[model samples]
Target: METGTLYIIGTPIGNLEDITPRAIRILNEVDVVFCEDTRVTRRLFERHGITTHLKSLNARTESLKIAEVLDLLKEGQSVAYVSDAGTPTVSDPGSQLVGSVRNEGIKIEVIPGPSALTAALSITGVPASEFLFLGFLPHKKGRQTQLKEIAQTKRTVVLYESTHRIIKLLNELEEHIGERKVCIARELTKIYEEVLCGTPLELRGILENDPQKQKGEFVVVISQ
Candidate 1:
């Protein structure tokens, strides 16, 4: 019997319209859809009228669930994996699952969709021929070291940050990079989409003054 295929589907980060036609077809046809959050995926499914079976696959229980997924694939059940938003395995938990399936000789396919990092970079007017995606920085032990590395990188650096910690990370960048040009993209592709560009210190002041602006996820782009 042939092994099943694993589809890494990328859902919209903010707006539902960002999903492609092919992605919608795959989501509806797949045997099962594994998502980080069932409720969140349910909303997307409901909007598209897709009634495919849903399963929870997140970092917390990925290890325990991998065996079950592998078994299903071995039985020739096709599966589609999607993160709560954006692409999976890009700061998401689908990497291990994908790797495990591949190691078992199962096929894997990526269904690319809206990504905050790529979307923000495209509109920032910044050169992205060479770039580094740092995802979310470490919170504690190696946080300073990671920031230092980002500061020294020659290529453009992109990072994902929570609204709550954006100010703190900006302060750290100001101290480490010192006057580097930065772009902060928030609520990307959504109704409140915003892109603020300036020196680290300048952006810091803007964010501080408008507390309401810091209510959504952020993508920080730093130019070398």
Candidate 2:
């Protein structure tokens, strides 16, 4: 009997229309889906009228439930994993599960879809032929060191930030990275989606006054 495949699928970051037909098909076909938020995933499933079994597998539940997932895969049952948004294991859970499956010789496949990283870069035109993606920066400890490192890198830098700390991060960038050209994209693929281009300080000012601009997810890019 053939071992089942592990599908690391990508879902839309915000816009439901961004979901690919292939991703939809895989969701319907998989025996089970391990997702970060069952409620969020349910909306997507309902949109497409899919009823695949969903099991919560976030940071809290992953360690406890991964053994069960591995058992199912070992039983020759194909399984799918998706984060609440974007691709699994990209600043999300599933890294440990993927690593474990790989070690066990299970077949793993990636079903690509919308990513804030790629979406922001697509519009920035910031000479990112070579760049480093730091995902989300550390929240507290060692945050300054990482900011310093981002400032010094010759290549472009890309990372994600939440609404609560977007302004704070831009302020930190102004102090650490100085007048480097920056692009800040928020609410990608949504009605209110907007991208701001300027120095870190300028972007900080824009986000500070406009409470609406600071309401959604953010992707920040800094030029070399």
How many residue pairs clash (N, CA or C atoms closer than 3 angstroms) in each of the candidate models, in the order given? 0, 0
Candidate 2 per-residue C-alpha lDDT over 110-172 given as tens digits, one digit per residue, 9 for 90 to 100: 999888888899998898799999999999998988999998899999999999999899989
The lowest-lDDT stretch of 10 consecutive residues in candidate 2 is: 204-213
The Cα error of candidate 1 at residue 90, in Å, is 0.3
The number of the candidate with the highest lDDT is: 1
TM-score of each: 0.98, 0.97
- On a 0 to 1 TM-score scale, where does candidate 1 land against the true structure? 0.98
Query: What TM-score does candidate 2 get on C-alpha atoms?
Result: 0.97
Tens-place lDDT per residue, model 1, 1-224, is 88888899999999988899999999998899999999999999999999999999999989889998999889898899999999999889988898899898899999899888899999998889999989999889899988889878999999999988999999999999998899999999999999999988999899899998888999999998
